[model samples]
Target chain A: MSLKKEGPDPKDWSGYTVGLNFGMSAIVGMLFGLWADSAFGTKPWGVLIGLFMGMVAGFRVMWQATMSNTEELGEKNQTENEAKKTDKTDV
Target chain B: MSLDPLHQFEIHKVYDLSLMGYDISLTNQSIWMLGTSLVLCLLMMVGSLKTAKVPSRMQGFVEVTIDFIQSMVKDTAGKEGLKLLPFVATVFLFIAALNLVGMIPGSFTSTSSLYINGALALTVFVLVWIIGLFKHGFKFFGMFCPAGTPILMMPLIVPLEIISFFARPATLTVRLAANMVAGHVLLKIFAFFCIAMGAFFAVPFIPLLAITALEIFVALLQAYIFTILTCVYLNDALHLH
Candidate 1:
């Protein structure tokens, strides 16, 4: 039952933040697309493009964040291993 | 007799003032924000005013909170993130204070409004944008591409990345504001049930108590989530990841 709080853990990042990003992007895209459709009278095509763009952005954010977290965890593990090796040498 | 759950959110002008073509009058929401911030500052300052080898409960609480925010910044933004600690700490404390105060019956919840949330979110949005550009110069655009993005796919990927960038503040604004509104509305409904049932109102009262406790947890959680996300975005600004 350790009460100590550590620096950012990959596990600490919740799916909700990611979901917030994805869901909002979709909404932003759809609404903006609709606005553009009316402005340009492009109607269906404008909205379709906007929705597609939003989905692309939303997925990309999730993908990029996951990729970066993986890289960060790998680096953290490498550092821990190195430190452990130094402790062994000292012992 | 009445259960208008959203009635709590209404703004009433205490001293209605029309300045030429503009309306700038004092409202309950404004007072709540001001009072919450003043009390928060006074307490945080007074709690740690005395330094001793043995800390009192107030001092201990203040120190722990400071440490928590400091570590959050360090963890999310790395070493350079320490520069934003004061700002991050202030934001967390202010929001948390408004939330706790709001829980007191009839007190206004300033943090529940989208206008307040939007302003705070936009400030973070602008601040991080400026910080990233200042720190990395033109290379700040590299944040959008991430690593290993092929040059040929830049056109398609770049726009998606840009849209995602815009989503940052929008999500931040929505998460906090929406949570507060939903929780308070539910609490109001349960409370209305508790009182309206009279002799049999105990059943509804129990759930109301539970919801009130849950609302408190949410207030703290929302503050924390908002602060940590700020740190994460600041990290992105500093490190371009």
Candidate 2:
């Protein structure tokens, strides 16, 4: 997460946006469906499908965020191990 | 006296300019936007006229502002995004100006309305899609499916990815517009309370001053967040990872 040793963490903001995107996706999907219902007179079915789709969209944001964080953790660990090995060699 | 805190949001048309049955009259919001752009342009143009190896105070301010946005873009979107520095900087300045100006009494905030922010977000939405398509050609469609997925799971993953992609602009729009509106409304309400308390106005005035100070910080933070978020979206388009 510390791409730079100096500045504040970038992941801090992105982590907050993860949950925000989930809420936004659900709202956007439901509103889109609501607009469609008004336009085409398809009330319940449109919403039903929209709800499922929105939920899936929200889950995707969470899943991708978690996956990326885990990947970063793995890389960080590898880098630390390599650093340790180099320190031992120097000693 | 009943004070209407939300009254500032009401747009009053200064001049009517209807062409092709479309109302394009200049409103309060448009005036503020134009004013913000003009002032910033003048500052940047005049401020940078005398370029120095070591910038003067004015030049330093302008240069630092540009550098800040440039660094944010480079950080999030990589070296390729440095090319988009001007556009990203313009957006940051534009939104920052609007937010700051709206803090002034009798100033209209262009960003408070979803009509404005929604359009801005939509433009980014279109821009990102266009950039992705132009860069990746037919392969841009693959963005809907994450890399290294099992073939059988593609069916479930693709639709979710598409929906999430579709939600990006909405999230951007909601975040900016909602923040501006909420801050302004809260400020107005507090100010009203402060004023209405004729005898004990000092008590409310203290909090009002604090909120005003906080709003300034918020203005800066929101601009940084918005710019960084834009860079992130651009990164997704460029890298699809």
Candidate 3:
């Protein structure tokens, strides 16, 4: 038995992230459902609008997730460069 | 005509101190936040100490969660940031656990509070700034202003970037708080329908149950969103690009 962690390759982690986003969106949708129900006295109809908002929110999260990974990679490179400079100075 | 739902926000003084100009009121929100913190601490202690060859169901769940966050970091932040695995993993567990715990009946979710989210966001914001400084020195400020913009566009782009940078915490806070408050408010309102529309209508309870389950899913999802966003922010700070 390997001690290594399993499930979800890092490159494809976006998919799971996407699922999480959708789940969150649904929660928001429920809220929207409630708000709309109260405001218009139309119970589930508000939920429909909320669900749409949630979908859009999820997409926003997905967009952020996509950009974040690339940015982290860039920070790591900077760290490496700084380290190299420090080493050269010491030598 | 009805009790203000927002009345729940009221605060009562728990301690009086005249010297420091600080009145420590143990607000309902504060109590809820404390409850969340205690639950998180207990869960951490249990999950961390429980190591087994076969693993109990709870332990298995914990292991799976760790693996999920770890993989997420590696994929987004890359192999270089594998060093931050511990921090990333812990944040994920803590936030996710806190969010999910709120799904329990009669539990108040601290993450749903703007105060809590703001605090968390501030911590992350500070962490990113410090990490960037450590790696890039004063150059870290450049994170607010990306490179390669034309000098003519500098005035517009730079300020816009700065505003966006500042808005990160607000965005994070609103995302978590709005979801929590909204979901619970809906649940409470529907539950009211069960009682208010007279005892004859049992139908509302079914939707309430369904929403409760959905709330559970929301708990986990919000936690995931919080953690993943942290990773993304960490990635940005680390990379400075």
Candidate 4:
């Protein structure tokens, strides 16, 4: 059925990945922190710092994805507007 | 009869072997992986051997799959990224094949295993690091620091960037494995309900069918996501931005 047809655009589909990336990055950060705590015997500090860093990383990833999407959309819109202007002039 | 949804994921050794001190056993996971690879290679060979101007159905399918991945790589990483077309295509097809094969009854989903996914993700991760370093040399570290940043923010920003950079492989591994595990577990639970409902099996059966369809979609989507992310990471390595 639809599987045989062309799939959705990768640009659009890429947006769906942001949430998974954000959550997983945070979990990974916390895991790393937990490992650090065990290695350094720093108890709660490692977890706390790790969680914070992970959250920051997650936010950073989210922000980067947003920025890229916006940039692509903006370029598309600009080209479309330019084409529209040229079409009117030709007419 | 048991309602344990995770029972499907349990690995069992088929042929036990040891290499040096490490246990190199062939399990259901290994078997399914090998089967998927073999089937994929056969399909490709068959598809390519009979290429025509109009193309047969098999050739068309192969062409479409390759075109999809090619465009994805071009879009994410630009023309230079086409250099990685072979690696990117293999990753996509292999992952998608594994996922689709796992949909069959009693088949093992190799991707559901963190160890397998971890290896794949780590390969991509390490490759990105090596490529970035090789291409850009010491300047590769500049990626951690954005183009413009106040000196005051370096301490805070650099560590965060490093954390996120290191988190890529973990994120990649967890995302695919978790999606497969979650989807399969849900499917198993629903199938159990269908059987347990006895005469009213139709009730759960309907939802089970719907979820199975969704799982198929997710299987392909996760593979696409994984490949696209690999392209993105490759882009970053190549361009350092």
Candidate 5:
């Protein structure tokens, strides 16, 4: 119920983390590309997929990293506490 | 003075070593890392040497730092993480100090360099991976597949999870390096603009000064983010949900 009262705040760091992710993802993508190229006998195709995957991965982290914070930690703790209470009563 | 933002990325070969049919050049970056690590060692040694009922300024600073890191680890990684405090604190302070020190005139940010950030990120990545594996073995890989994931989604979800797992180091490296680079470059660019635009009005100095303070905040904030993320990763590894 309280979840609706509070949603994710606008973090100033939002886009920037994504930038970092893309950079690293590109490198990973390149490595993946090389493997794929060798395996598939396709020169740039694998690398292209790597690049795409890296971008997707980078954006994913950007989203996930934002979800991680003190507030979320608190929420998790609260949930755990509630679960424990239910277990104790049921037992 | 003319400004080239990417000038920071230029690497000059410090020394070339040839062994086993390979050429490796020790760089300005390698030196900076060595220097930062030494400074951190001396800092802790001196900080801990004179433990007193009433702390000296240096001792007090180190105590505050340790206490801060301790609380952070406890809060995030729980008591089990307390034993790893020294290593975590060392990494936090070393990276934070080095990142700040880079802001000084004529100093290069080791963190701004991809290789340096990569090394640090990879080290943390490897540590968490090893610890997670040691603690949970092959079961640690189960971390990717969440509890309620649909059975039909396993094929698509598994690969996504694997890719996500591999992406950690990349994210880590990029976060630190990019923040370092972006902040410094923005600071430099603004200062240059301030100097150039001064003939029209003194307003440029305001943003210049403001950006300087913001840079300091960014320096510390990025460091905290980097360290805290490290702790979170450690937590996930330890808990292995």
Candidate 6:
């Protein structure tokens, strides 16, 4: 009997977390930027820079999440393909 | 009933206490949190009091929960993550219990408070930092810069990476707290509608029941998400890539 587990992969659960992570990263970046500006008296430059950094951070998170998901999918496909090849040889 | 849906989140002082200049008064939030922990402890103790080969219902439950968490840790962080099974299990069970308990009518959801969730997230953040620093030393900083990045891009990438790194705890805290608060407020609003509708109270009652069920699911899901994310962060610390 195969020991392979059934049901959705646990890693798939991480997908639910992406939306919030993206928004929060941007907000946190901007907040940090604002604080830096107030401390250094840079005013608008700080906010602009911070906001940009936050957006970049947000995109980075989305990219990472997408990359990991695709990696998992690739692995799953590889295993399935190998299994199919073995079955074909048996037939 | 109060039409204000957010009224459910108000923290009321149950006992007055102070230390030095700090107000250490016991509030409803603290009481509920304590109650949840105590109940969880009692359940755990009761569930494992007797061991059997065949396994009784309580023993089976305990085993299943631990096994589930163990597999989760293993899957996410690999073999080394199993070392953290007890910690991860405790966190998952505690948050799940707190969220489920909060679903009780008239009970305060301690997790709905930003401060509590913030503290929980910060705990995980500090733990990750300690583990990463201890395990990798100065090499851990290398995580901020991905592999194969040109030196020219480092200036832009480093700050973005740093911001995202710090954002982890913030995201964790906000996600859990916001989910709990939003679910509870939604339930409260629907409940108010069920009462305020008077003649057509049944109209809102159906949706209220559905929302309650959804809230319960969210409670479990949020807890699971929080624990899994903790494991993921721990993975980064353990395996730097």
Which candidate leads the pack in DockQ?
A: 6
lDDT of 4 by residue, B16-98 (tens): 99999899899989989998999999999898898799989999888888888887788888898999999999999999999
Clashing pairs in 4: none
Tell me the lDDT of model 4 at A9.
46
Give the C-alpha miss distance for residue B134 in model 6, angstroms. 0.7
Query: How high is the TM-score of chain A in model 4?
Result: 0.85
Q: What is the C-alpha lDDT profile of model 6 across B1-241, one tens digit per residue?
A: 5678898888889999999989999999999999899989988888899988888988888878877787778888889989888888999999999999999998989888888889888988998989899999999999999999999999999999999899889988999999999898888887888778899999999998998999999999899889988998888899997
Q: How do the residues B119-221 of candidate 2 rate in per-residue lDDT, one tens digit apiece? A: 8788878889898999999898988877899999988887677778888888778788878888888888888887778999998898888988998888877
Per-candidate TM-score, chain A: 0.77, 0.77, 0.51, 0.85, 0.51, 0.83
Report the lDDT of model 1 for residue A81: 100
DockQ rank order: 6, 1, 4, 2, 5, 3
Q: Score the docking of each candidate (DockQ).
A: 0.41, 0.36, 0.06, 0.36, 0.17, 0.44
Q: For candidate 4, lDDT tens digit of each residue in A1-91? A: 1233443444565576778768877777888899999999999999999888889888987888788889899999999999999999999
Estimate the TM-score of every prediction.
Answer: 0.85, 0.87, 0.67, 0.87, 0.78, 0.91
**lDDT, candidate 5, A6-85, per-residue tens:** 32232323444566555666677667778889998998788887777766766666666666654576888999999999
Q: Is the docking of candidate 3 incorrect, acceptable, medium or high quality?
A: incorrect
TM-score head-to-head 1 vs 4, winner: 4
Q: Which pairs clash in model 6? A: none
Model 2: per-residue Cα lDDT over A16-88, one tens digit each: 6787788877876777778778889999877777767788889777876788777888999999999999999
Show model 2 residue runs off by greater than 4 Å: A1-10, A31-43, A66-91
In terms of lDDT, model 4 sits at: 0.88
| CAPRI grade, predicted model 4 | acceptable
How many clashing residue pairs, candidate 4? 0
Error of 2 at B100 (Å): 1.0
What total of clashing residue pairs does each candidate reach?
0, 0, 6, 0, 2, 0
> Tens-digit lDDT track for model 1 on B1-241?
3468888998888877678989878798987888788888888888889977798888888888888888878777888989989989988998888888888989888888988999998989998989988999999988878688889998888778777888888999999999999999999998888778899999999988899999999999899889888887887888875
For residues B1-241, write the lDDT of model 5, one tens digit per residue. 4488778756788988778988776787777778877888898789889999998988887888778877777777878988789878877898888888887877778888777778877888998989999999999988878789999977656655666667767787777787888888887777677677868536767887888788888888778777777787788888877
